[model samples]
Target: MALAWQGVRALARREWCSSWRQPAEWLTPLAFVIGVALMFPLGLGPEPARLRELAPGLLWIAALLASLLPLPRLFAADLADGSLEQWWLAPLPRPLAVALKLAVHWGWTGLPLVLLAPLLALAFGVDDAAPLALSLLLGTPVLTLLGGLGAALVLHARAGAGLLALLLLPLQVPVLVFGTAAAQGGNNAPVALLLLGAWLAVLLALAPWGIAATLSLMLD
Candidate 1:
């Protein structure tokens, strides 16, 4: 257990340093989210009520799209540099390693989106940004986990980016629906939040193993 944690910390440190060096990897998605939020008011006109009504869906969609921008690079760097091969031979389990890496990936890519969501929600005229913020808090990690699986599956493909979006967007629909509903904060908001939490739990349980298996097959 101690050794596993040590490995996780080491992997976390390495990933953090790598992500820090490449500003665009983390920054582009943030910029995309902001751009999408800003564009809606221009396109839809400056009605706070209408914008507030639409804010939940628009913000969730932006977050969903922005999450994709960083995914292709998730495993590409490790795979290219032979770090994944070393991981295969390490004492740590592949699924655990995948989860750890995804956790770090979420820290760089998903965390910013979560942090920025409330501000975007306000910009969209949401009366209370708390529900939107709460929804994103539970939802972004799921996005990162699903994205990691998608990234691993398409890592070797020539047009992996396009394929990643295609594969991931459909799977993300449930999250989109529930997250938007939760952010909208109706009588059903609690239900939606619960469902979102359930989805997160389910994905966390399954995604790492799926990613690990996919990478193992690719490595073999």
Candidate 2:
């Protein structure tokens, strides 16, 4: 057990280091999130009540789109450089490696959005940053996890990014709806969060294997 965890940590650290070397990997999505938050006010007018009203949905949409920016690059570089083959054949469990990669991806992309969401909420005149932060906390993982599945599904495709967006956006509808409702402090916040949590749990159990299998087939 100790050895397995060590391997997972090692792989995660390696992935993190590789990504850290490339500022654009994390920064581009972050910039997009910040840009959307800033731009909507100009287009929507500067009324506090109106900005507050739109903050939940607008921020959620921006976060969702920004999440997409990193998916295509998630496994592409590894595959191109032949590092993915080493991961698949390593002594460490395949799913664990995949899960670690997903965790790292979320840490870089989804986590930044969650942390910055409150500031964006504040900018949009949202007094209760709690709901916005909480909604993202529950919602972004779903995007990242299911996104891994889509990323793997279209890994070597001609237009992987377009296919990834098409594959993920429809499945992400429930998450978006519930996340927006939670951000808006609707009556169903608890139920919505619980549902999102359930969705995340399902992805955690399933996505790693799906990613590993798809990659295995493609690489073999």
TM-score of 1: 0.96
Please give the RMSD to the true structure for each candidate, in Å: 1.1, 1.1
* Model 1 lDDT tens row, 1-220: 8987788888878888998999999899999999999999999998988999999999999999999998888899899999999888777899988998998888888888778776798788776888998999999998998899899999899999999999999999999999999999979899999998998999999999999999999888
The CA-based lDDT of model 1 is what? 0.90
Residue-by-residue lDDT tens digits, candidate 2, 1-220 = 8877777878988999998999899899999989999999999998989998989999999888988998998999999998898897677888889999999988988898888877999889887788889889889999998888889889989999999999999998888999998888868888888888888888889989888888888887
Q: What is candidate 1's CA lDDT for residue 117?
A: 73
lDDT of each: 0.90, 0.88
Task: Quote the lDDT for 190 in model 1.
Answer: 99
